[model samples]
Target chain A: MRYLLLVYAAAEEAAALDTRLALELAERGGLLAAHELEPVTTATSVRVRGAATLVADGPFAETCERLGGVYVVDLESLDEAIAVAARLPAARDGVVEIRPVVRREG
Target chain B: MSSVATVFREEFGRSVAVLARTLGDLDLAEDAVQDAFATAVERWPRDGAPANPGAWILATARNRAIDRIRRDRTLAGKRELLARLEREAPPAPADDDALPDERLALVFACCHPALAVDAQVALTLRLLGGLTTEEVARAFLVPEATMAQRLVRAKKKVRAAGIPIRVPPPEALPDRLRAVHATLYLVFNQGYGPPPRDELCDEAIRLTRLLAVLLPDEPETLGLAALTLLHDARRAARLDAHGDLVLLEDQDRSLWDEARIAEGRRLLDRALALCRPGPYQVQAAIASLHSDPEPDRRRIAALYDRLAELAPSPVVELNRAVAVALAEGPSTGLALLDALAEELDGYHLLHAARADLLRRLDRPGEAGEAYRRALALAPSEPERRFLAGRLHELPNGG
Candidate 1:
């Protein structure tokens, strides 16, 4: 199974996403990819409404906790994904939302 | 309570636990076991009983699960489940007769922290209480559909969240054990409350006894088992023949189960010997004292003080005041009760206790008012009747 872990944190805290942690997961063949977002200021949000395309000023909506980073990891179970999430630096000061990645496997 | 019902409850929970351990899927385990029970219901009467019902149930449920999985492999993630099932060894002939008791694992799964507390209680009852979803819903006073949805969501969360279905790791034992104890206590209390469901109480005791045996080293487990036993010891005396409430002082001593009281005292002593005091142990200790022919009220009051420190709740304080009234005087108890009035105004028992103390103090007027307040808020018929009777005893109230 694969899970997408989205870290909700301030840009400063999200900037602390651990490269060493990613490398460690990669070594274990569990890390598919992980990235810290550049910054919210340089982002644009787009939505489709009826026949019109709407563009927004920021990433989705401005909030205290922005979408700071994301990690997609392949693991056998949700517990394993949670173990990885617990290791993320952003988790110390912010929240990490874990959603099991939908897979179409035979 | 019949022969068949006894066999059904015992077999249902144990088989689900064992099968769940082997199959690694709660829904599959439960469904297959239900299917097996359905077959037994149809076939047992005509064919007579099996030599070993546990083995028979396990074998039948395993076959049903494999068939269900093989037939419905497209159900997402079940392909993995089927593949895993295929790799597992098939149940042996009569050698597989006595299934390993892995009900504790099912217990941990049902009481897993990932699920909400309400979900935890309901799941424990459904999975371990040998209760159908409808029975569980009725026990908790919820609609069957709502309870079914809650159980469904809890199982989904347990599956998707990768909550392990085995006894928790030792390092995490203390916290996990607290949750398991609390869930069981809640079940027992629900059963012990007015218009009581003796079946739920029995199930809670049955499971907690299993827990104490499995984890004998854990004092609180033994403490909880003791607590339930002590309370249940007086079951026959809780109400009159007409089902009106019977105050403890008025209850016939002959109706109390001496053997259960003795067993409860022994368990409490064992828990205390552990020297790791907990709220359950204290509660059990109080119950043991109450069971004594000549209970020491002073000690009961002091234990309640300790209980307040341990649990820190208004309920404990209210109990303490009752003990104080018996130990000290009605005036002293009444003063303590008055302090708790604002905090426990919503609790009918507090008002009832206050009325009793006031009546003892010869203040019929205040006692009548308190009794009326209690009668207004008492949650059940017997309790209301008891309070009304007390109100009529008051000079002004009559």
Candidate 2:
């Protein structure tokens, strides 16, 4: 199974993380891919209405904790995904939502 | 005589647990076991009981489950898993000792911390107690549909989250053990409460005993078993012939089970010998004190003092005050009760205890008022009747 770990953290908490630490954590967690998002200030939100595409300024919603990074990892079970999510530094300061990726093929 | 009902009660948990292990699906295992039991109820009387009822049920349940899996087109993706189970399904164990006893694992899984406490209790009863969804819903006073959805969601989480259907490792045992203990305690209390369900109590005790065997070195496990046994020993004296509440002092000590009391005391001794005084051990100790022919009120008071330090709560303080009243005097207990008034205003037992102390001190007026307050808050008929009786005893018939 594959899970998308959406890492959210306070701005300052996300800033404090060095590349070395992030890489180390990703390696330890068996992360297939890890991407640190740009600051929430640079985010552009998009939504699809009945027949029109709506655009918004700032992130999807205003919140103290912002989506700071994401990790895509393959694991045997949701328990393993949770374990990996707990390892993310952002999880200490904010939240890491683990969502199983729907497999298109059986 | 072996009846289908007796066989169902004895074999339900064992069959479900073993089937779950083989099928790797709790819901399917439960369904299969239910079907097997239903079939037994229909066929047993006409055919006479099977030579080996447990094995018969297991084999029938297994065959039924495999057939269901094979026929369900929606489970096409799981064809490989189903095929594996079909090939590897072993015959049921010949003896009780050989039985898989997967209930321990099922309990741990059901009580996993990821699920809400309410959901955990419901799942434990449904899965381990072999209760129907409606029965569980009725127990918790929820609608059948609501409970069905809750169980579905919880089971989905268990499967999706890959909560292992096995005991946790030693390092993680402490935290997981608390959840497991809390569920078992809730089960036992439900059965021990008014309009008691003896079967639930028996199931809880049996499961807790299994837990004790599985965790032999864990003092708290043994403490819990002791606490349950000690309390259950007094079951015969807990209520009157009419099922009204009977206070401890008013209960006939002769009615208490001496064998169970001795067993409880032995377990308590073992738990205490571990030199680890946890909440359950403290509670068992208090029960032990209460069981004595000539109970030492002063010693019980002192133990309550220790317990307050270990796990302080309003309920404990209320109990401690009652012990102090016996050890010291009514006035002293009254003072402690007064301090807890605001904190425990909504609690009927606190009010009842206060009323008792007040009455003992010859303050009939205040005692009457307290009794009224307790009567208003008391939920059960027996408890309300007991309080009303107390009120009627007041001067001028409060």
Candidate 3:
């Protein structure tokens, strides 16, 4: 099973670089991809309605926490994904949303 | 009444547990088991019970599951898995004896912390306890439809989220075990209280016994089993002939189940020997003290003190105050209870305990006011009646 861990945290909290944990996850033989996004200030939101493409200056939706990073990891079960999520540094200061990746056959 | 019915009652959880492991799908396993039971109900009476009824049920359920898998169009993608399952040799027929105990796995999955506590309780009762949705709803005082919805949503989450159906690794056992223990304790408490329902208590004890067997070395598991047994041993004496509440001091100790008390004591001793006293162990120790013919209130107070340290909750403090009153005096207990006034203002038992202390201290006016407050917050008819009786006995007829 592959899970996408969407890391969300406050801007200031996200600034704290903890690349060591990401390396640890990769060494654990599960991490497929990891990337820290630019700040929400640098994000541009785009929406496609039936006829128009509406562009906004900020992220999609304003919440207490902003999307800070993402990690796609292959794990045995959701429990394993949750274990990884709990270890994320952002999990202490914010939230890590774990969603099962939908696989489409070629 | 029939042997088939008896087998269904006893082997339902075990069969479902085994089938779920074999099929790798909880819902499919349950449906298959239900179908097998229905077949038994239809055939057993006419043909006489099979020599090994459980094996018959398991084989029948497996065949039905395979048939359904092959026929269902939506399961086309899963044809390979189904074919592989069918190709494997059937489990050896040993009646109910040879079935691997997959119930512990099912129980852990049902009580996963990711689910709401109520949902965990509801799922455990429905799946592991062999309770119908309506029965669970009735036990929890919820609408049947509400419970049905809750079960559907919880099952969906179990499938969609891929919650592993297995006991957690030993290192992660403590936290996961706590959730399982808490759910069982909640079930036990529900039946241990006013308007008591013995069935729920029995189910809880049964489930805890299963957990104890599965995790024999876990001290907390043993502690919980001991705690439930000790509390349940006194069930007969918990209420009077007229169905009113009986205080522990006034209850007929002769009515207590000595066998269960002895068993509970053994479990508690074993748990304490591990020297890893968690909340359940402390509570079992307290119950052990209370079970004594001449309960050592001082030791009970000390146990409560330990319990408060382990699990710092207002309820523990309330219990500790009662123990202090028993060991020391009403004044000392009253002081402790007063300190908790702000935190436990909404809790009816706090006022009731305070009222008892005041009544003992000869403060009729204060006791009357406290009793009234307790009555106002009291949720159950028996408790309200008990408070009213106490209030009426006050000096000024309050």
Candidate 4:
């Protein structure tokens, strides 16, 4: 099954990574699959009321940087998934958040 | 073991590769090939060798595997694996054509992206190039145990992931090929760099030749070969009788290997003609320019500029800055280093570069400080000595 590998970095550190390198890594891609996201500060959130939709100020948490990017990868085991996660460039500087994606029930 | 069987066991990896791809089960094919060798040891001497030793072995292994599959608990899976094996031509080791074709698959297999970068190099050296793990480890300056672990982990990952044995699809091949190129170049660097001076250079050259043969038309492969030759051509001039480094300009150009330089330059010209610029090609171009009787500083500087543009990093910048120092002047290079020093504080070469520029500018005290910093950050004894020598040469001997 494929799982999402989410990268989170310190805001300052993320800003420090050379754009050329980061973009090259994104373009070169990796074995499973991955993509880099814009910085977390630009994120928006939403909430629901009985008959109205409400927008929040930002992402679920307030931190230096959050959800730097996500990689969806097909792996054989959780150990393998963790291994792949650990190798990500961001993993050297930040936390790599791994979560199983729930399939939609039709 | 019979002499013939011993020879085959010594050099039967290509056989295993063909069997593995044909069988579509790397582990099982490995086992079957081993069993075939065992049978060969028992029969080759008595039978005076079959009309075709490879055919005899293949037929025997195929029959043995079929027999085992008939009794296997996972009959369906075994049957599928066996069917895949049947798709490949039976081993014909005596036939040059069959051996090269099978070995070609093995080369691609060794370069599988599923393998970790380190594993790809280690495994390629082991299986395809017939190198021991110790030899491979020594080439990379890593502990043998660590190299073994890397190889084991990579193969385990491949098996666990069920990585297909076939070459990657066309769309995916470029990245996969890059990984392979990087691995080869890494191994080559371990040989090219002046130090340890072990016989690993021979092994590296052998591996590159194999890669060139397997990837006949790849300009990058040729570029890699050229890079190795050009870099190695200057090996004799890099050190003095006491093993101290002799800076390029001070070294005796007569010590350079002319034949290797000529070959490397020719290959580099062809690679550049292809117009597909890559990191290796750029590096080869730099090496080629340096090999000339009167290396054009402008050409060398321009090549480094392109290299920095292609793969911009503090390391590239530092190298290019050296060329810039040569082509332009110390002041221009010093300005560039001054700007980059903060970002590359922890990097040894940065301090070394700064120290060099400071020395040229007659700022001996600052140069001494930079040299010391570089000595502290250096990973090897030789580099530390080089830095220390620079510091000792300061006017006040700081």
Which structure among the candidates has the greatest DockQ? 3
Q: On residues B147-225, what C-alpha lDDT tens digit does candidate 4 reach at each position? A: 8888777665555444556666666567767777777677777665657444555556656656666776677877887
**What's the residue-level lDDT of B85 in candidate 4?**
53
Candidate 1 lDDT tens digits, B1-398 = 12345578787888888778766778988999899888888878878867667677777887899889878846666766767766755556466444677888889888876679999998898887779999988888899999999999988887766677788678667888898998999899989988788988988999898898888878999999999999999999999899987888889989998988988888888888999999999999999888888999999999999999999989899999999999999999988999999999999999999988988988888888888899899999878888888898788763
DockQ of each: 0.42, 0.37, 0.44, 0.05
lDDT of all the models against the reference? 0.84, 0.83, 0.86, 0.71
For model 1, residues A1-106, the per-residue Cα lDDT tens digits are 7889998775553564678889999999999988878677878989999999999877877777777889999887665677788887777777788887766766
Using TM-score as the measure, the top candidate is: 3
Q: Give the TM-score of candidate 3.
A: 0.93
Cα error, candidate 4, residue B68 (Å): 8.2
| Rank order (by lDDT, best first) | 3, 1, 2, 4
Flag regions of model 2 displaced more than 4 Å. Answer: A4-29, A37-54, A57-68, A78-105, B42-51, B76-79, B83-89, B92-96, B396-398
- How close is chain B to the truth by TM-score, in each candidate? 0.93, 0.90, 0.96, 0.83
Off by over 4 Å in 1: A4-47, A55-97, B1-4, B77-80, B90-98
Worst 10 residues of 1 chain B by lDDT: B89-98
Off by over 4 Å in 4: A1-106, B1-13, B28-76, B91-94, B100-108, B138-146, B197-200
TM-score of each: 0.87, 0.87, 0.93, 0.71
Q: Flag clash pairs in model 4.
A: B22-B85
Per-residue accuracy of model 3 over B241-339 as CA lDDT, tens digit each: 878898989989999999999999999898889888899999998888889989999999999999999999998999999899989999999999999
Instruction: Give the TM-score (vs. native) of candidate 2.
Output: 0.87
**Model 3 residue B348 lDDT?**
99
lDDT score, candidate 1, position B194: 89
Please give me the DockQ of candidate 4 compared with the native complex: 0.05
